[model samples]
Target: MRSIQRLVTLGAAAAAVVVLGACSAPSQEPSSATDVPPVPTVAAAGPTTPAVPGSTTAAEVFGPGCASLPTGDDPGSLSSMRLQPVAAAVETNPELTTLNDLIGRANLAGPLNAAPELTVFAPTNDAFAKLPAEQRAALEADPARLATVLEYHVSGTRASAEELRAAGTSTELAGGQVRIGGTGDAMTVSDASGGTANVVCGNVPTGNATVFLIDTVLVPQA
Candidate 1:
């Protein structure tokens, strides 16, 4: 009877141990991997500013002629003009009719179109009209001379209004230096002849060049 009781007690203890071991055992089923929250993805930072093809920022259209500029809907606006080459861009502006004609006559349209980058100081029709009759006749009579005069208005690089203001001077294709002055809307460009032309509408971007519409034709020194 004592042996039987001891055997029974041992059997009970073994059964309890088995129950506790079963309770403490780790779960065998697959973990809830799908139920777990996923780590969040981070996005990369963008450039502080995406650079426009020409000009630092959208230019503030200025001067007396600003009123005459094409409205936002017009095809002649800077946005639309930039799609065309410099010569074609100038041709679209009625205010620059004289300059456009001269460009055509001088056969400078080709060169201007071909140039990778340029800054053209385009004189208005009024500017050309202001030139002495003799000077106009001489230019019309001499295509080569007219071409040189036209070249005087161009820089080999794209020069925006801010750039011109910062540089204060730019060498023209005609081998003459043009002096730039003032800040912002008051910017001016002086030719070798000491004549100053106000940049009426500046930072005009075109396909091949940046154009600054001026009030006077730039004349190169002899």
Candidate 2:
């Protein structure tokens, strides 16, 4: 196991270098732990189960994307966010900067955080990047349109992974229906935009909502 130990040491050294570089970098809107692009998911230091509704146990968070989050109890970590409102929790998640900024611009964070129960299909920066240029530009340019699009990603009822798969669909806050398919990490969501988004990391939790990081933005239908 000498090679394995060496690899681990090398990995830690590489991570330290990155941390040092980021610490020395110019200030912008402060980001989650690393400035390096994060995979499409939010904070978690470990994996957990996704099928339990209304549970925010740190041990209940799951998905392949979990590994990318910064470890420990920083404001950006899963354990720290377990008691915070969904909108508040997203504020410190690295992969969700684009979504966080849009929510701020659209002024939807208040409603999202205040809602008693919700299931948020949060899109990552990469997801926004993948959005068609004209569509993304239009949404960004108009707060009203952006609000509708953002609402389209949320459900009024909080649902666990099994519940989502069992129901097959949910009505979004935008008053439109979205179809949910697959189970756990393989789950996918489809909206009126006719594009499908995979749930890269499923069953994340906050005080008032269950969060799922999706790989695509869900556009609202007319």
Q: Which stretches of candidate 1 lie over 4 Å from their true place?
A: 1-57
lDDT of 2 by residue, 1-222 (tens): 222233335546877899999899986654666666645877676755444354456665777777776568877678766778888999988988899999999877766666657788999888999978998888889988788788888877788776788888888867778899976568899988798998887778788788888888887787
* Decoy 2 TM-score against native: 0.73
Rate residue 11 of model 2 by lDDT: 49
TM-score of each: 0.74, 0.73
- Which model scores highest in TM-score? 1
Assess candidate 1 and give its TM-score to the true structure.
Answer: 0.74
Q: What is the lDDT of candidate 2?
A: 0.78
lDDT by residue for model 1 over 154-214, one digit each (tens)? Answer: 8777767776777889988778799999775788999888899998887777776788888
